[model samples]
Target chain A: MTNTILVLESVVLVLLTVLVAGLLRSHAEILRRLHALGAGLDPDAPTSELASMPVELRSRVSGSFATAADLDGAGLRDDALHVAVVGTRHRTLLAFLSSGCLTCQTFWTAFGEPARLDLPDDIRVVVVTKDASEESVSALRKLAPPNVSVVMSSTAWSDYSVPGSPYFALVDGGAGRVTGEGTGAHWDQVKNLLRQAADDASDDSREVRIDRELREHGIAPGDPSLYRTAEQIAQESRA
Target chain B: MTTTLAAHGLAIGLPTGWEGRIQRRAVSVAAEQTHAVVHLANFALPEERDDFGGGVTPLMRSADVFVVLFEYGPDAVGKPLFATQGIPRVTADMFGSKRLQRPLPGQLGCQRFFTAHGRPFCLYVVAGSRAYLPRILAEVNGVLTDLDVAP
Candidate 1:
């Protein structure tokens, strides 16, 4: 009888140890999952990691810029003797420059080389300089790229509310809006501005297209159904 | 030497030497969520120009100041501050208070945090020269203290 009682006690101890170990393992798994969810929601998470997550998990971020002063009042050149900014069907890069600005001179010197600028083909480059006599701007005109349009406008500076020389504005002709505007002290900054504007334009076009398609199908782009399928469609299309 | 500037239910005094402009837009973050963003640009040295590098630098290339007001939904109350592109993260001491700063090239940068209203806002200021940082900070501190946000 003594031997049997000792054996039963040993069996109970073994069973209890196994159960505790199992509970600990399950708790560890739960903790790991919680950590992952926290990391996914972290704002500082890397772009690559955010991209891999589902769209619903990623939040939307937006930005805005001050309204650019109207260019209509700006008396742009339209004479046969000089190139005019007659609006283009595609996006236009309106580079505000002045002969009096040393910074503007640097930009013009670099802009004279089309190969160096290497702007996307879809974007049309137009240089808007202060209205000056042909003789006054003759030296600056010679530095302009052959393919780019150079226009002289008296009100261009104030119309755009340009803070300083070598300011740039990305004008979306189709939308009739200034997509992006800022001052660039170097040629590389100008290139970056163009690239960013191009990306923004592309995104805008995609959204517009999606909205139009949804409207055609008798569904509002704001409808919940559209969003439900947007991510899946975006994933498939991207793939 | 100051002018009254107002936007997003808030009003403040702007220095006379600065050119203040505001932009407002409605942004759709999710299908069921949409909010407004107010962007303000203050040009301190409109005539001066500086060579600020590209890629992560904020706008107002040469000594300029910018203020961005972001409105978040009720759900964002407890969330971390959303990281904005092009603004590098930094630690700085401002007016005897320690705050996280986002310093861009050319000494142009901003610092942002959630306000009492649960809205994320940023104040960006650029000095014409490094020597002007102290003066700029004082001015920025005044603006922050004087800001009147609508509840």
Candidate 2:
């Protein structure tokens, strides 16, 4: 071949090689992002599931009424009830709670019944609090998911199991095992796990009527007799 | 007696002569780059600290000092843009611990609190960052040095 032609061919080859490498690197980055999205759904799952499984609070309750009754019967008042509520979830919703927790206050504005309308019908959400009082629960209830259960467990502060506020767990109620648990920077990921748990339980046949169970345990369902009503709760506590 | 310290960053006014040394510092790895530290010397008498949970030295006690660090700036209102660091230590050891005490992550950031003199103060301290550390400390030290106390 002519010298000029040889030089031109070499130049073309180098350009093609660069283009190929660039494309591969870009492809890898895209795959990495896609994998991250996929991992949000399930560590081993594909990307398509992430969109289909946006973290949501399913409206339906988890845990057996029998179990809730058992907890109530055990005199799990105030904080203990909160623990039971957290324990009942298919996934643990770390209660970013404290009488003065700033994160919980931020989330109080972000999460709530009206805001969580976008969530599915079966996801169970709960609030964990260090200070479990009728007043605190009333204030928090205004900012929680509808039909989302709440528990104020001071024991959670010392559970030694939970490292900080806003910690979460994937609880298998049927198995009573914490299938997945984490703290700090994984709320969205844990929310995804909660949705996943609900999806997983879509096929499991177990139902617990919380109110009836509480009644059986001699704990009234609509509202505890300690306070006349939600409005009076704050005042009563102050008194 | 109510003594009001002028607004520097997140603090509106600190109670003067309340037996506390307020030092401000900028945090380097926090959402809010600037922060402050308020070390309340002679925080509480031994009895008061015991009345409340002991994990934190209650500001109401005599021996306890409330050391708090937060962000300060004009753009501080109604924004998730600051961090807070608090340490309940002894008045003698306010500056002993180099590591900032951490509260629950999301639970912290911004706050409004009252001092013993009933002066209102605001705070926003971000974690792991030190953007305005020097300025915060200088201003707080100046205030403490100039404080007029009632014996």
Candidate 2 docking band? incorrect
Candidate 2 on A1-239: residue-level lDDT in tens? 69999999999999999999999999877766655533232456544543344433332345321112101100112211212222232323344344344334434444553244244432344455554442355555465554333445455445425556555554443354544444432245545655555654563433245555667888764555734777787787899
| Separate clash counts for every candidate | 0, 41
Stretch of 10 with least lDDT, candidate 2 chain A: A67-76
TM-scores for the candidates:
0.36, 0.27
Indicate the fraction of true inter-chain contacts that candidate 2 also forms: 0.00
Instruction: Quote the lDDT for B60 in model 2.
Output: 25
lDDT of 1 by residue, A1-239 (tens): 99999999999999999999999999877755543433233457443332233311111124454333323211121121112122224566788877665556667777667677787755666677776652256565466665455656656667666676668887665455567776655667667666666677688779999888889999974676656677788887899
lDDT of 1 at A234: 84
TM-score of chain B of each: 0.57, 0.26
How many times do residue backbones clash in model 2? 41
Shift of residue B137 alpha carbon in model 1, Å: 64
Regions of candidate 1 where Cα sits further than 4 Å from its true position: A1-87, A133-148, A214-239, B1-151
